[model samples]
Target: MKTAALSVSSEECFQPGLIPRSPRLLETLLANLDGMVYRCRADAQRTMEFVSEGCLPLTGHLPEALLLNQQLSFEQLIHEDDRELVRWHIGECLRQRRRFDVECRIVCADGSVRWVWDRGVAIYNATGEVEAVEGFMQDVTERKEAAQALQEAERRYRSIFENAIEGVFQTTPDGTYIAVNPALARIYGYRSPEDLIVSLRDIRHQLYVESERRSEFMRLMEQHGSVSNFESRVYRRDGDIIWISENARAVHDDAGTLMFYEGTVEAITERKLYEAEIRHQATHDALTGLPNRNMLHDHLQRAIQARQKGSMTVVAFVDLDQFKYINDSLGHQVGDELLKTVAQRLLSCLRDTDMVARQGGDEFVLVLQNQSGEAGIAEVMQRILAAVARPWPVGEREFHITSSIGVSRYPEDGKDVETLLKKADSAMYKAKEQGRNNFQFFAPWMDTQVSNRLDMLISLRRALDQEEFRLFYQPKLSLSNGRIIGAEALIRWQSPEQSMVAPDRFIPFAEEAGLIVPIGEWVLRTACRQNRAWQDAGLLAIPVAVNISPRQMNQSLIDFVANVLRDSGLAASWLELEITENVVMKDAEKTVATLHALKSLGLKISVDDFGTGYSSLSYLRRFPVDALKIDKSFVRDIARDADSAAIVKAVISLAHILNLRVIAEGVEDEQQHDFLRENGCDEVQGYYFGKPMSVEDFTLRLRDEAIRGAAGK
Candidate 1:
């Protein structure tokens, strides 16, 4: 492609001889100049005398059109908006024979405007004749646009910096306040930004409530060159401390020297308080305000880790035995208050390092660290039992509750948290079975007991199939009348190996394995059949009582007893149902309905283990019962313990007032017998009278008693 160029003339001698000789060199030089250079004649309309092809791009007009006057004139090319200004600057410079400089906008042929800086010198003849002018016009559009953009961005940034909710600032390395926004002034309790910069000279001593916080902040910034989410408490202008979170970065000089920090500061006192509340809610029980299970697990884990060398760690499950009675009788609000009091008493039983957690409901778990042996565990357990058994004032009445503790140790009973908890729970059951208000240590033998229970559970099903279970009758003597009145049919297991299994050892197993339903049916049928046999044998007509488990009592026991009596052809008066205090007190309304239904069949309902449960006199009176069997514990200690004697008298008196007969159990001596007789007890049955006997032995005793009565001996 061919290009065009021009040579400078003597008439336009502004830097003459600067033009290149070769057209290509001229073209290259002009294109690289960034603006066009032009020389035109001083005509009525200034005509282009010599033009560089660069003019085509700069003015958006081809050089040929301008040179031949086919395009608009040069003066007319100046934007009309600024033509007078440009012409004035050029005319004035020529009249004074000096250089001219003007900044103006020129309209291109494409109608777009360009900003240009024009600098020119006027040339004249020696005789002072009119001459030509020459200048360089360079584009200044890029610089103009960049300056405008910078201004707009600054405006927006300044608005945000001033109005932001968080504090914004720049601080020097030496802690001097360089600049602060308006929001910072408001946050720091300053009247204005200048007031903060002037008054708060020492950020470490003046701003921070704790001076060490400043040292920490500076140390972090030095190490990382930035600190994000840096939180601290600082004093405002009025000396009130508030929490703040910072996000900051270091701003260095051109040489990368440590300069200053620029950052945003947010007030987080409210959020910090909210987070603390959430943490408290997470760790504390809502009802009792005691430490909850989450905190307990955490404390237990910590205690396990901090266990002393060569010492055992004990984790105890402390459970209130009859708490449900109180909860169901009273209201939940009262229950909550009672639990709180219990938690306080439990906390008093342990050291500060030990934790007592409300493991949900009326159950609590405790962690004991560095115990010497079973002795240490026993001591803590006793303390806990005593503390919980202390009388509590619930509403108007002074209520008392007892706790059962199961202790599991580390390295012996269990090695992990879950195992320890399970063993502790098992031990707790043992404590409850031992009549609550006491503690039991975790033993390797306890594991054997559990394994035996599992083995019994598997064998119980087969035993029912093989008829390995049998019934033994324990006679309940009428102490007032001194005659055979009724008998308790106790279930016993005779293994295929001819081993006699205690009822205590296997009854609980059968109940847990769901085999009691069938075994209890067998006992009922056998007892009824034996009672019919005694009637046929012409012996004294006595009702044979059979114990029904809580599980069995949950079924239609009234209908079952009626069916058994009908099948065996035994009168309803010849069969009686014996139930424990726990079974009756579990669901009082249901128990009352069941008892009434059975009483309608002319069968007697007797509560076993009386004075041993959380039965209220109000609920007891509501039961359709004929007899109350005093718990053996009270009878065992009636001769020695004054409390036992008083309890026995109270129970008998209460039973009589309710129109129920009272019977005493576990009378092992003449002293116990005399005690019961003196207390006005109506019946007594224990080892002192006769131990539980097999069916054949009881039948033989009946025959012997009948012979003696027939002779009136």
Candidate 2:
């Protein structure tokens, strides 16, 4: 480690003689320099020959300690790791007779590492031999550390951009892509980030499905400088539309100049589609795919609003006639199909401006908008009636059904949606009361009728609890024997307020309200008990028939009848069950089964008003019935009208051929009685025999008739 001695002073190294300057001024200049000025020998030890005053601050060592290698050699101050590279660089420069410059690490006297820049030249002697190297060295650690920190930050930013799941992007304000990550490319349906950036040059036209969305985005950005959860529909690279949500901010430089827009994008197409489906299900009926009641209310309100502008809007409530009978008899499956068919027919019958909505279970509400007057509405209503009446095939059979439509016009019928619907419903019930299969315009009178019906329904419920109903008996005379054989048990509602409520007054409503099931059961039990009581009192034991509605037939009628007969101790033969032809023809198969069941229980089953319904003769043969009652309409004119008389004769002949008895109803006069008696009619029951009377009156009449008969015999 032997080193050369210093042979040069600081003044000599700075060449004051060549510059022609004072030593004091030169010393002051060197002292003020940012780094140490030095001369070193061309040796491995690099012995220092001259050192400036700055050497104390730069190297944390005194100039005397550095000069002449008094305490430490300059080569020893060089960092071990950078010493060889520095030597090689300086050596090559000296050989080429040029100045040398390099940056390397150095160890300060305090043992802290410093980055240093060194610049020097080989000073030559007169014979071209190397004397020493002159140089200046300065600390550059701060600049080097700053550059390293920047490089590390850039690496971290690149990692985040590549790995993020949400799309990250930077775009110029002019809509050109500045930078985009892989996630952004995937969201836009591109193969790669480069492809997306290259292809999507115009974001407004190429990205947004609606051009206005882009404008909106820019407006929001300008106003608030950022947008969060901004949703919009945009086109993917493949021309498919998708929903996207963006959270973006306008990036700016330190001087507040706009640099670019940076944002994140999320694909939300699946979520949007799911939300739409849920909305549709909420507003649509599941069975018929029609607008449901909720949607109908909204639609009707809108229609009323439209009508307020001097135009009429008709709200029609359509109820399918006999739909419940068909539904209960066949099954709910057929009912649903029938409703769908009705909905389709209703739609076909109306203009495109109209709407048909399902108000649940065989009920539809129609909105006819912007009508001219009654004529226009009437025509549409008629069309609806005709359309609904058309025969439709269900399963293996072609079924015919009808609609009862009630129409309430906006402005004329109350002002609001509920009022219009209420009035329309009331009018619809009137159509049912007027014998169904028709349409009725809402009249103010219908409101009172609706209220009365409502009151009656309330009373009917109370009547059941309070025993407000009474059974009246009408005698049936045997036309062959000229003797009373049996009686028909008819129900009478003796209201506390009204004297009597006829069967026709509340029967239809009770059926519609589903109260008939309970009421029918009550009637059966009471009629059976009364018949057994008459037998117990030593009156002639005769069969008493109780009318059965279609609704009652669909229930457990056979079981109910058996229970009644058991509880009343009346033989089933003494309690006949009467069913209308329409009820039997509704579902012939089910009716046949019910009839057989009753017959098995020894109850007489008669088809009442037989000629009124369209019953197939083939199926009629299959019904296990004891008798067929000629409809009152036919019997009312049987004596005078040849057609009625001929029909009655044919029915009696047919009944005899089938080995069944025939009863002619509504026989009001001697001519009618003689006509039925001469025509082989087995039984007769009507006002002619006697009007339906209370139990006590009928019992007294029976006693008087028995006395008179005994005397006549």
Query: For this target, which candidate reaches the highest TM-score against the unseen true structure?
Result: 2
lDDT for each residue of candidate 2 in 68-107, tens digit (9 for 90 to 100): 7788887788899998999899999999999999999888
Runs in model 1 with CA error above 4 Å? Answer: 1-57, 62-106, 117-138, 156-167, 182-195, 228-247, 266-289, 292-317, 327-337, 348-351, 367-399, 406-434, 438-713
Q: In candidate 2, residue 517 scores what lDDT?
A: 84
Stretches of model 2 off by over 4 angstroms after superposition: 1-208, 213-278, 286-288, 305-354, 358-413, 424-446, 592-597, 616-622, 640-659, 670-679, 701-713
* Alpha-carbon shift of residue 536 in model 1 (angstroms): 29
Count of clashing residue pairs in every prediction: 0, 0
lDDT of each: 0.83, 0.87
**Displacement of the residue 223 alpha carbon in candidate 1, Å:** 3.8
Cα displacement (Å) at residue 416, model 2? 2.7
lDDT tens per residue, model 1, 1-713 = 22333654443333456653555555677667768777766555767766666677788887776673666788878899899898888888888888889988888888999888889886676888657777788788888778779998999999888889989999998888999998889889999999999999999999988889888888988899889999999999998988999999888889989888999999999999999889989999987788898898787878888888998878899999878667644645677888888889999999877878898888899888888877777777888888888888865678889989998888788777888888988888788879999989777668776676677788888888988887887777766766777777888889875498888887767865778888899989988998899889898788888888767876877788889989999999877788888778777777788888889999888898888766878888888889999999999998889999999999999899999999898889999988788778988888887888998999987887788778886
lDDT score for residue 522 of model 1:
92
Candidate 2 local distance difference test against the native = 0.87
